[model samples]
Target: MTKGKIKVSSDNIFPIIKKFLYSDHEIFLRELVSNAIDASKKLQSLETMGKFKGEIGDLTIVVELDKDAKTLTIKDRGVGMDEQEVERYINDIALSGAEEFVSKYKDKADTANLIGHFGLGFYSSFMVADNVEIVTKSHKKSAKAVKWTCDGSPNYTLVDNDRKERGTDIILHISDESKEFLEEFRIRELLVKYCKFLPVKIQFGTNEETVKDKDGNPVKDKDDKEKKITTPNIINNTSPAWKKQPSKLKDEDYKSFYRELYPMNFEEPLFQIHLNVDFPFNLTGILYFPKLKNKIEVQKDKIQLYANQVFVTDSVEGIVPEFLTLLHGVLDSPDIPLNISRSYLQSDARVKQISGHIT
Candidate 1:
């Protein structure tokens, strides 16, 4: 194992990553899980493109919390990184596109001042954890597993790991200030909020379901004790409404998806719009009109913005037209830059085009 300092022009990058990008520190869970999904999806894409010849077995992302160890681990059966990739992607933050972003936006005083910018997805883990470790093995047959460890500082250590799996595991040692993330309920809630619509299936814990008897009643033992079975708790929908063809979806399907998007809301939507456009820029999603009881007060931030099925943000003002904030739904596009603030979106040509299309 060799220890080295992360290559960066500015020493302020780590502090900015931990302090600035988001107001809610729990967003670290969303960013880490989202990156795992991206890695898994990239591997699947490679296999589909005839580049990878290995089995894409069980691409489910597993979030395991160990209270005794005071650690949280995110495991994925996706495309893992070798030693060099660990250095290039994790160690060298500047080359990974964070340098330019920090250089431009690091001077911002408050978290509220930043918007639409989320280039610090992986680094967000540092917000909640004092130390983070990554164990990864590439998909190549001859590849060896490697482990990368980093503290909140620029110093990091990389070493060989004996892991036999072809994926990655991110282990985070919870800090004293971020112990809330170790709670099962908090983690579950965050998973439902941010990762419910992710393309990859995420497993957190085990769920219990009552067993049924032959007569369709609850199964009981000789003493009339109810029988139950434990099953894997899969958190996300591998295929969401936006990724499907509009023709293939029915009114009920759209309604069901709306409920999936907003689980707390009970009011049925008055109408819905399925957005699918490719000419100007790739965008697809469903927008719903809730019954406002003829009230002029419209709810904002109800709409969720996604980048290729990964939830980006709820603040869609910069991309969506001002008048359309009345409607609630989802808008997903790959063309939208993932690392810019809301103000940047206004000046961005692609965002302007997307806003025009929405108009």
Candidate 2:
């Protein structure tokens, strides 16, 4: 057996990819959903260019599980990649190429954009999966479908495949060590924590469950009378409360949504500010000020910022004003770069301007 030429300059990137400064292992949800959202936006751009005349149906991303098979799939009806696109985007994830892409699009790209600022989202898959496959067909009708498979190493195979649809389906061969990714409850929690307000619809489970009785309560099944029947609570909210117009919404609606977001914290929010600025990309949001104990740490569970309604992170110290860290509740914005460090923000004036608006 012969080992082929190494693509990138660094063989040491895996350590950073698997376990870096990222304190939370759940960021994989944000990365994958962001990829889906990016694909959806690309499709929208194509529609405007008269590339795809087909009606742009609902841009919803779905996660399905095969517990018995120990598999997980993320399906997106967005701008899928053709064979060449797969080669360009999937097969080669060199950090140098990422830097080049940033340079090529820098002038026109939005500073707050979420195009793998850390250049590590794709690699995050290797953190959990032993094998990952990308089945994608570009939005272009004539583009050839490509199936890219990788085994958590430098090597990958990109071959032609058949897919009548115009999107991507990422099937993860769940590793025994990472079987938790296949759990509905775990994925649901991650989605609620990270993707509650994503611009695209993310359906995790069934739409309806019959276990709940007609009285809107869980009913004990005749066969299982000894146990109270459990009903499924659909976790992801495609159309988050922040996305709606504040004028059209009632005060109670915001409060209810807040409760849905932070159920553990029962205390009422001090005040809620709905942010619906549309000039610089589609950023819409609401910021709530939950009551904080004076003795608590200044950064104790601060505002959770969302990109395109997808929950980014609660440690939004640099994105929000320094003063705002004392507050709590949702801060959904598509522009806030979730992964970028404060050192980067200091150099970028636009990011600083966005931070100024946090107060």
Best candidate (score: TM-score): 1
Q: After superposition, how far is residue 4 of candidate 1 from its true place, in Å?
A: 25
Give candidate 2 regions above 4 Å deviation: 1-10, 19-23, 94-119, 210-234, 265-267, 276-284, 290-299, 319-326, 333-356
| Model 2: colliding residue pairs | 194-311, 197-309, 197-310, 198-309, 198-310
lDDT of 2 by residue, 1-359 (tens): 89898654435656666667355566666777777777776666557656569878978788888899777788899878887767766655543223444465556544234344454566667767888899988877688888889887677888888788889998888888888888988988787777766656777776544466678766666786533434344456667687788988998998998888777878889888887776654556677877767675676465765554555556665667666676666665545544442111232555676666655
The 10-residue segment of model 2 with minimum total lDDT is 338-347
Give the alpha-carbon lDDT of every model: 0.79, 0.68
TM-score to native of every candidate shown = 0.85, 0.75
Worst 10 residues of 1 by lDDT: 108-117
Name the regions of candidate 1 deviating beyond 4 angstroms: 1-10, 94-120, 213-215, 338-346
With candidate 2 superimposed using the best TM-score fit, by how many Å does residue 329's alpha carbon deviate from the native? Answer: 2.3
